[model samples]
Target: MPFQLPDALATSDDKPALSLLRRYYGDAVTSAGAAAGAAFDGWDSTGTRTADVDRFTADDLLAITFLSVRVPPRAAAVLLRDRAAELGDLLAELGPDRDLVGEDEPLTDDCWPGWRLQTALRDIPGIDTTTATKLIARKRPRLRPIWDKVVAKVTGTHKHQWEPVRVALREQHHALHERLVHLHGAAGLSAAVTPLRVFDVIAWREGKDRGW
Candidate 1:
């Protein structure tokens, strides 16, 4: 059978690939947490990896919501599980270092892109690379290397440092996200399900309350 599109369907800015996704999924599109929720739900529905000291069972919610953004559907399931496992190891290895790093300096403005990615991830709780990858991708958005907090605090920056209050606030805001959502529409866009947008939404909200 030949294919057709609805009159209301929006074209992808570049790839026809997105159009196909839009035609089928439509407004059935998701809100920000949907994908992570799905991945989390999917994991939970199965009951796979819930141990302790490393309780990353399949049912676990989301290590990092952004992860689903980069992974293709076929690869997502396996990677989600593997990422969760990796997160378990990460938690065991570096998750406790936050205090040692402390709230003292945070991440100042002059830091490199690598510094930016790591600080953002650490600030956001319950996120692993799968979730962090999206944020990393945002900084690079090209799938180069995952610039997560552990790598920065432990590997990249060497010593610990906090970002500037304004910069930290900027990093957390994710202000452009809503625009991206409106331009792309939630359903067909992969970003819909991830924290990629949530980061911005959360930040924008935090900024609004700063008057106190």
Candidate 2:
């Protein structure tokens, strides 16, 4: 109801989106061979996707979604045109919470209309505990599990079956997020990983038993 994810990796769309990110952005995980400013985001909504610019790849959903929403007037013509400048401004605003979304344009949902974590993951603000904990491996260049319909296109009984894995990674991500906070401070990080964005990430990894 609120949001969901599949228990297992059932979505083929993930590969396309992820591949697009890896091919174009090369790497979003800086410490893990990814470029410093590279990102691995994509969109799978019923919305149409446009070509990206030289600066950024439009194939990935992040650019597609951002550009689509930010400026739909000429979506077909221009995407990621001023992406670098926009990303720079956003990074300055979100910094530590950079992964949440495009920085200042804080993401929200019916639950967290303001800058707060979801109720389930609120206990761990700036980081959605329930969502991040699922299938998240404990390692550097750690990917904060993102969300989309691919994950929930169907209903799986073993929602979040990777709780053990999630639990293991939760502590690490928490520590890392905290470390980032200490390094960057709360305002930027918290503002960056808004509830909706984080929720989307979590929801993207949903299943039948997911609401845990």
Which predicted model would earn the best lDDT? 1
Query: How do all models score by TM-score?
Result: 0.26, 0.25
Error of 1 at 150 (Å): 24
The residue-by-residue lDDT of candidate 2 on 79-112, one tens digit each, is: 2353345432332332232232222232333332
lDDT of each: 0.33, 0.29
Clashes of each: 23, 12
lDDT of 2: 0.29
Off by over 4 Å in 2: 1-73, 76-78, 82-84, 96-144, 153-212
Provide the lDDT at 37 for model 2: 20
